[model samples]
Target: MNVNGTLINYYFHCKRQCYFHGNRLNLEDNSENVSIGKALHEERNKCNNTEIEIENIKIDKLTKEYLIEVKKSDADVEAAKWQLLYYLKVLKNKGILRKGKLEFIEKNKTKKKILLFELTEENEKELCEITNNIKKLILQDDIPKVLNESKCKKCAYYEYCYI
Candidate 1:
């Protein structure tokens, strides 16, 4: 399966999540968190008709200076960042270079509301390895160990991991 933005985001947020999504065992449709996020995404995309979908990538907005990604919350900044980075990579590969702008529509007691990213050589190198790792991870016979963190409770795959 192609490693899309969701897979990249899940890989950083939770390894098991990435594995489940990569292996095509999706259960996100039942989660309230996913629903809320999708609602936010739809609302944003509705305005200006900024959503651009190409292959497996759906960018929120693409401007001369930035390729914007709108997130419902800043719950997992790293996950969002990597997802945006992957999008940047995709654009770069297509000869369309632009910086990444992450806009969090909701904040969770965090001071950060907006973040910017540029595709550095180091990040690009790491991304290459990350994609390969994800491919191998999903192909494994055994599932990844469930993370017992508090975030697991809010994850869509909570029941699969905990119950």
Candidate 2:
């Protein structure tokens, strides 16, 4: 199975969520928050034509020097960061190289948020290791324990995990 951006993000956010995703138990369709995020992505990218799809990954935008990811919020910056980094790795494997840019449109009340990232030797190595771990975790018969229930309220798999 190909590890897409969603899996990478979910792996960072919640291992249980990642396992559920890898196992094809999708609950995002019943998620209001997920719908809003999808709408935000579609609305924001409608005017921009840089978005592209590669394998199981969807890049929000790509410029000459950067691969940009536009997010509705910065609530989970770490997950977003790793997701973007994973995209960079996929591109690198195809012989392309570019810097990573994360754009959080609704983080601060007024100011727009943007962070830049680059994949280094260390980061690439770590990501590979993480990817392997994720694959193994997802294949296990048991679901991972919830790490934080407070964060579950905003999760797409909230009901699946708690209810």
lDDT of each: 0.91, 0.89
Q: List model 1 lDDT by residue over 1-163, tens digit each.
A: 9888999999999999999999889999999989988887787677778899977999999999999998877889999999999999999999999999998876454554799999999999999999999899989998999999999989999998878
Model 2: ten consecutive residues of lowest lDDT: 103-112
* Candidate 1 residue pairs that clash: none
For model 2, how many clashes? 0
**Can you write out model 2's per-residue Cα lDDT over 61-97, one digit (the tens) per residue?**
8888999998888889999999999999999988889
Off by over 4 Å in 1: 107-112
Per-prediction backbone clash count: 0, 0
Q: Please name the candidate that would achieve the greatest lDDT relative to the true structure.
A: 1
Residue 8 Cα positional deviation in candidate 1, in Å, after optimal superposition: 0.5
